[model samples]
Target: MFTLPFSALALSLCASAASALNSKRHASLAQRIKSEQPALRSPVWHGLGRDTNFQITDNCTGSTFFDCFDYFTDADPTHGDVVFVNESDAWSLGLVSTTPTQSFLRVDNSTSLPSGQGRNSVRLGTKKTYDGALFVLDVEHMPFGCATWPAFWTVSQTQPWPLGGEIDIVEGVNLNPLNQMTLHTGPGCAPNTSASDYTGQQLGTTCPSSDGANAGCGFLDRSNTSYGAGLNAAGGGVFAMHWDGGGVSIWHWTHDEQPCDLADLSGSPDPSGWGTPAAAWVANGCSPYTYLTDHQAIIETTLCGDWANSNYAAAGCPGTCSDAVMDPSNFNDAYWQINYFSVFVES
Candidate 1:
């Protein structure tokens, strides 16, 4: 038998303890990997020919929302009778609030007054601009009322509207229950409806700015649950927009029907795996890369805007747009409750 000195024995014990700790740590890591195996197996690219995977680059919620977006205090460029409030004003006026789990952007629903400029609301735009990427919004409620015109869209920060392009993911006016997705580009770019894969009805073939207001190629989702009151009754849902060199596409999924892939926040999103989109605009005579660029996400609720006002008669709402918008009680449901809004970039 070999006898070791006291110091040598102590050193051996210390080495054994360290080895045990390391082994335990490795085993814990292995267990985590095993638990996440199912999610890891999901494809990152759905055969889009892009070698990169989509990873969440921004998760805008709660405090993160304020950090990512800037409040627009300027008048509505769409000729909406709206008074866009700043961050401080929004909170003070109860137009905006954030909890640990959710965020709220709402219009004034407690006061009764004439709709002159419009109701008090908040309009938020992302501070950072994006060229092409994936945008996903998990909403619990969206603004919808007799005189409300709410929109979740994107536009190029560049000067000259439409020339920089605009993409309206969720937009409607008055009592419209369905969403209308549209794309407005500079010129030459148009919806190749024949080549696009979607369930929406194409309203136009041209996307030039010269086509006039609401002139961009449009696609209407006939599903009532895709927007407005129906959407809220169904407990809200997820709206996803995928933009790349191929073109831009939009998808909607009811809260309960959302794909399992989207439930895993840590996993990469694969748009290719998503079935036929609700609306898609494939490049035709024009190049998407040139038409859509430097766009920033925007969320706003305007009262009796150009769209809502012009279509008021058809909406069958009592009185004029201004009259309907002035009643605070009527706009109690005119608010947006967002669970989360995320942006993903190619990896």
Candidate 2:
């Protein structure tokens, strides 16, 4: 989850602490598993389960745009220096707009605020919640810039924090060239041997959000064109996330590279024909029902939050995150031009 409301450095330190404790407590089990499985496996995605036919349940596009989501006006959970305005303010400030072909959610790139004031932005979340379903995000452009943290994610709607779970499908900070997919949940959930059976590079195998270390299981998509400036230049395409009893799979494709099935979203979606996904977290043993449920999808752009602030210097961006926010031009490209957000369920 991108917005766990904790500092990234703190999370890393907490994870290290948890790891140390786990190492002492589960040494034997860890050793056994290490011996049983190879440290590295093939990068190819193995079809663990066949895809099911899907029918569109809710499609947010065109005239029904504003009706599909609610503008979140609360303070940012990630502590970003952003002010999330309500629907009226969003429209009045030009932070949100919609057309028959596209909908826009953007940071206030034209107004330079006071030195300490947060930038005006919009965070929109779906009104409907989902348990196990297929989510398709068709975008034309995504937010990106120094100190900008943009994410398209889902968190449990009914449970408290990590108890339910959070899934970050499209997330990245600063000028990162690749997309990150992560899961933040409680204990008793970890990846199996087949966890590496995806195109993306696996960052972690554990999926717990305890000890203040929301460093859940994560994968990094290898494609440079999967996010940031490259994604905008290539003309954004489809990002599909399949979540069910079997597991979770994420796929990303540039507009020119998208599969034929996605070309016409009106037809039923079959993941089996979509080829290997960009990332996959197979259940093998991890129970989706127990760890993840009743999630509401979200799209937001924040500034100098937990992740972005911690990695500010490392990303080689100029000045402080605060400094970047004061410059209106810094966020000119920090916007999401979305074509549609559609949820599909098994037929």
Candidate 3:
């Protein structure tokens, strides 16, 4: 054995101890960070852009929800950074009604829009600049009332209408949270049953249920508050949707709450957890066509008619487009607030 002076041995031991301590400190930091906001391990899709503009709701152009000929945000779209307002509650912003034969937006701007837009019309720019695993949008609150439909949604830039795929982040009727995650394609839409929707990952692919299915396929998910309440962009929560080519899923996260992960949705997406696709979406026309590969922008505010028009009482609901759904009596006068619209890619 090599003998060493007492002073030398003490110095060597001290150096080793210091090194070990530093390693432990570093490990601790890594753990803390992991717990706070874990990194996206299998992040297939990612957010291409993000903005936290406090003044996003500073433009106007569309018509009100009260017998207006045009929308308020028509002339001034507020660009990519601007949040289009209803302006004067006169232009319906082109939003038509879908049910009960009425079209409206209840002119109200508590968040930012001095001007109100309603039913299927209102723009905050588009997700056109981004393309990846998927796109997620979080908005303030959706307008609610009979025939009142608000949505935080997306549309394909390359393809139009059903071909491109319509992702309705928030869609409901009456004053309920029957928030729905639907994929509209071809002639068939709204699969009506959990089994019809073929979305396996989010719906439970562990084993097909007794119904001989891969979980609800189409418009999976239906709920009032428990699930819907937590997902309404109106109340301010993370009503996020996932899309990465062959997969699609919707998640509802409450304020300051972590979102339910794939494991949580292991079972058949709760009864209301993006429950199942609608009945019409299961037919051959709709199945195997829910992947949105080319949407221009992500709709982050409340939209009426275009998707939430209820049952189509407005002139534009069934067909005619020129009969503007603008009316000044109704307005949401609300501004959609965002913490951060971020995107993460799968590495």
Best by lDDT: 2
Error of 1 at 113 (Å): 1.5
Candidate 2 C-alpha lDDT tens digits along 21-92: 576665688775765453333233234233447788887775576788988988889889899999999989
TM-score: model 2 vs. ground truth: 0.84
* Model 3, span 187-297: residue lDDT tens: 333332333333222332121112222122334343343223344432545454544432445555444332222112221112122332221222222333343446544
Worst 10 residues of 3 by lDDT: 52-61
Error of 2 at 7 (Å): 40
Instruction: List per-candidate RMSD values in Å.
Output: 12.5, 13.6, 17.0
- How does each model score on TM-score? 0.84, 0.84, 0.44
Instruction: Report the poorest 10 consecutive residues by lDDT, candidate 1.
Output: 1-10
* Rank by TM-score (best first): 2, 1, 3
Q: Which residue runs of candidate 2 sit more than 4 Å off their true CA positions?
A: 1-51, 193-196
Compose the digit string of candidate 1's lDDT tens values, residues 152-197.
9999998478888899999999999899999998867755555337
Superposed on all Cα atoms, model 3 deviates from the true structure by an RMSD in Å of 17.0
Deviation in Å, model 1, residue 227 alpha carbon: 0.3
